[model samples]
Target: MRIVPSEISSRTRSAAERSVFAALKAIPDKESVALHSVHLPAHRYKRVGEIDFVVITPELILFIEVKGGGIAFRDGKWHYGRGDGRTETRTEGPFEQASSGMHELEREFRQAVDGLRGRDAVGGYLVVTPDVDLPPMTTYEPEHYLGSTAYAGGRGLEAAIRRAANHWRGKGKNRSALPTISAQLRGDIVKAIRPEFDLVPSLHARITDLEATFERLTTEQLEKLDELEDNPRLIWTGGAGTGKTFLAAEAARRSSARGTVLFTCASHTLAAHVAGVLSADSIVVLPFDRLDEVRGRRFDHLIVDEAQDLMGFGHLEKLEELVHGGLDGGHWIFMLDRNNQVLAPAGYDPEAWKYLRDIGAMNASLRRNCRNTKQIVKQVQRYTGADLGIPMAGQGEQVVFAKVTGREDEAAQLDRHLDRLLDDGVAARDVTLVSSSGDWDNTSARLTRRFSRIDRYADTIGAGKQRNRITWASVVDFKGLENQVVCLIDLDAEDLRGRLDAVYVAWTRARAHLWIAVLPGVNHALRELGVAALAREGAAE
Candidate 1:
């Protein structure tokens, strides 16, 4: 039951003391015996220490100390500290502190009883730690200590005090006098401790100020303002590594102020991920194909993510129908990267891109790649034709280039890379493998079969889903996901004429290191794009 005095900051301690006082008032016999009292004057010689609660009956006076933390006891000492700050230094343990405090209380009780005739007196100390671990007793002790975690209910500490009170009652003490003692104890404790708890309003004010400071927009915020403002129609643009989905979700959250916000995405898996992150009571998400169904539903705002795959006049017409029909002067928000546009089935005009641009919609772009390192971003820039909007100067490391002759050489190369990264203190979650195609499922299976160390996912995995030693994904599926290091395999796909564009998307997905695996015959388009330098000597043969 011993608690760290430092762990109980003045702010929290005051609140705890108030809670104790409130709990005492609910006890049945609080008023008659003056039995409930707190912060009553100790004997003149006893040292001054603020007690959390004091309950007095005619038979007994109880002293309580409240500790709130994830309490731990190890190596014969009680440890009560928060992990958010510096590690706590253990000195005199909780047992010693509580025992000493109890000794002091006993001395004060004896002094208080000196003048009272024919009154039996008892003194006990109780320690309470709410929501913290407690150690089992190795030896018997006189002081009562209980932890909220082990106790079924929060009343563990109070129960201990009641037990001691019951013991004194058994000694022929006058039970009728309990109420007067309780009321006096409650009043005295509240008076002594009220000053400490009064600081909460000011503390809350400071926290509010901090939140306001965080909300003030910087240069990046200004660009977002312009992007959302300029594009009145369906405008879609996203930074690959940046949390585009999360930003889109948050935009939907804020858009609720203007009107009802609806979320839609091309990929069902990606849509589900976004739905999991953004689904709240207020916002709604519907499948992109379900635009017809959504047309009848009234909404104030519409947001579409992964818009690259939603090509052709039909898709655009459906969106227009939803906006014109469903919305009541609502805004439209679209999140996408145009270069990430993979093939739309035949008969679809790729010219849909030009139409959105010619419409004079707000075309805002996020320049700062907040998710990836400058080196990896630069490498991605070499493959993808994205303009480097600004120069990034930081202490982050560059992407690593590993060239192998063929797919057969990939297994050993990947194993070595994994070992080296792990040896360098890289966590498995920080690294990822990106395949060049949907065929990545087979690619990941082959790699996992050869090297059991790698972990792969078929769909896009966000920062929240990373739990394994290493995550492997296809470049297409991993579009919105990011990692500290990425190994991009099968970059030399013959079917993808603009393969460098996909490679660029894959490269930027890396925040620190990028490892690309290309076949022996490098694509000409990739060569023209300058990412062909990633191929080893004679790789294009």
Candidate 2:
């Protein structure tokens, strides 16, 4: 129930004020009974300063002065810093100014407002921008004309606003003379503010059971998939976490309805993930090593996911040979990200992944990543110096780089970390712990033993269904897969150098949070690789 709409527009408000306003909109009680951006007394408004937000509730009306940027009270006066580190301009009195503004509002409303005809109470506060260090103050006050005392910034302001709303809702109100118009209040405010309010309260994209959009394709991805149907032969490429395997599954599901669809990849783990999601009888998910078994069979469409991985083991001539002899429509699609070509015992060089372009196949590249938050993508980009393009940003934790004592501590740290992520509402299935090399017992077997106790993804299909498990995967096993929270553990300078592309692939696996774990006395090279030591974590084995 919006009584007075916020009149602050981009033209009227500075960027900082716009930020504050956006934050206010994200508040749960934003649309609930409020008067905003008001300078009352009908027309003599210059005498009274603007009240940024006034939450009108049954118990109390809260008058809030919203300011963005660094607000610190130091050296006896309140100073408003522009957040540029330097340039803290002196602002006279935000608290005193809000107090006086509320006084004028109450005095004028004594007669102007029919609801508050007699004695009534109000509250005032100064809501500053996030990360602003507000000096200590009273949580509540009663001596002033209006109750003006609470000082808040960021999420604290949301709590203050909610406390006022819940306080009013609990007491219940006499709405007979309320300021809210019956039919159009919410609509009017939504229309007025939706354009200007364009931010989440927090910056990261969250991953949870309810929010599975981390794997869903953007409109751009869907358009590319739709466009691929027209072309007989196509090569689709994208960075890791850009939904290559998901697109391949989509292709298999769609093509299976008409004719046979053969879906193949480099890893059996990814093949199994694809198999679980695609139920079409006409689709067969397999590895590239089994190409000879179905040598003479004709498939209407041959969809290759993780093309670099598949092409890593096989030759271009063999791929061409399979395509030439086995297809109903002679149509094939190769979906891969070249940067994801991690080295194996016998692996193709980066040059081998480019053979498709020589064949004059229609090509399309997707840059807008469908997985990983903007922050996670930035970290991966900083490390690899690759053009992965900006992500479709979502809410999640910042990337963490930590050094531990050894394997035992790494195990303990991951155990605690997994618990914290689950408590934060990330699905257990959405959290994955990965290692660069599977051969090292300290790195792989140590963590794998502990992970074996948890409910996790099984390597075999016949193994009974498992849910709510913290998944463990080799960095290679995780190709074309993404998780909400991923810990790239047991990686040091040696591991990172041994598989530089693996680091790029592993880092991009995080849809929300990326935590890189290393051992003590082994982080100097990793630091050079752009993964700085955040804090000591693991213990000795």
Candidate 3:
């Protein structure tokens, strides 16, 4: 038998449905087609009903009802085990349920199609209990029901269905001649039951799915949290996209139950994003610059995200004052990406590492790259030499490096890329444009003037949105954040030495797709990263 959908389309929670679906697939007759999970409206039945399986053959159409697990009939109630350590009680048995649904479906067919006035009932209902055997009940004929033992004893479900169809075929008034269902009618019946259409998700919806996968914590992250149970003063070191922010937020949330918790990060934008994630009253989330907000207040536990940035500039002294017993005797967790410190080399001091070691703070490494796809991770590792570890995410689109001649040409290329992404279904909010230099506002202004849909990034990376417009952000401000699509602008090979770290940061920000608009002279830099510029150059407008 051919299935309407070659495979089950929806994720079904019912074990019985799944079992029946598997059995239906084994039907030997190639001429028959089975529609799984047919839904019915509330017309004659006065309530919505669903037929588990609809088998259409040349002889008859069979509406099947499946009941799984431990089953019992007692005190006029049907009790069955729900496979989740729970028993569900129902008043209506499977036989009556299937019969009424079949009648309703017949009525619907008569109303939906034309010229079928008083034709004989060519189909009937069958009850299947895959996990239990039912005693011969006085209300229904034995031919209409198939229990677990029937498969081993008889020729199986297909044979039982043939027998049931023959039994129903002789019941009508014109019993002398058997009625045959034509192929055209069977196709009509399938369409009437469930119309077919392809539902392709929008670009934003697709990105949302990818984002959900990226947000899930891996076993390593969970084990790291478990390690904290033994020692709370461990420093977690990992490369970019190692889920440092997610780990920090979760650690702060868990620590809040013990006592007061302080969750601070070097980036104010990152702090705001973390604050939005953790809302417990005992947890205080803020940036290093905002330590005065909690002056004279000491927390029982401190979780520092982006800790590499806080090692110098008197930031450690401030954190020491805020955390109980300072760093030496306090309960604290520092989550840092050592490679990210290159962005702020002057602010990171080597003495801080010695201090952490001298104090015997436990250390752990998070090696999984949970954010970027395998393709993006490869490029980032190839270019930046950052050990992002294994790429947990699967294959993704290849990184694109589009060559441009000048600022005007670069802006035009960027606009065209944005249009293509949007046309391909990516939402404007899911894409971010990062400027390589400090002139982010100027870039935003220039781009906004060129494309009205472009605007400056105003809110924290992960929160808030300006619905229909794409955002432009600075390379520095968007650290510790990510987006579904990232397009790095103002890439100059002449100034590559000064801002290689910034470019690395921008490259790693993309979760699924990354596009770099390389300036005219950046072909040499592209070659170093093992990427060739696209054959077509942007036309200057």
Candidate No. with top lDDT: 3
Worst 10-residue stretch by lDDT in candidate 3? 532-541
Candidate 1 lDDT trough over 10 residues, lowest sum: 198-207
Q: At residue 72, what lDDT does model 3 achieve?
A: 88
Residue ranges of candidate 2 with Cα displaced over 4 Å: 1-216, 312-314, 321-329, 340-346, 349-354, 439-452, 455-464, 531-541
Which candidate order results from sorting by TM-score in descending order? 3, 2, 1
Pairs clashing within candidate 3: 203-425
lDDT of 1 at 228: 48
Give the clashing pairs for model 2.
204-394, 204-395, 204-396, 205-394, 205-395, 205-396, 404-538, 409-538, 409-539
Q: Model 1, 350-399: lDDT tens per residue?
A: 68767755563566665555566677667666655554344343446666
lDDT tens per residue, model 3, 451-534: 566666646334533235677777777788787899988768865654556766888989999999888778787565433112
| Between candidates 1 and 2, the TM-score winner | 2
- Cα displacement (angstroms), candidate 3, residue 351, comes to 1.2
| True-vs-predicted CA distance for residue 469, candidate 1, Å | 3.5
Alpha carbon lDDT at 324, candidate 3: 88
> What lDDT would each prediction earn against the true structure?
0.54, 0.58, 0.72
User: What TM-score goes with each of the models?
Assistant: 0.51, 0.55, 0.58
Native-to-model Cα distance after best TM-score fit, residue 284 in candidate 1, in Å: 2.5
Candidate 2, after superposition: displacement of residue 263 in Å?
0.8
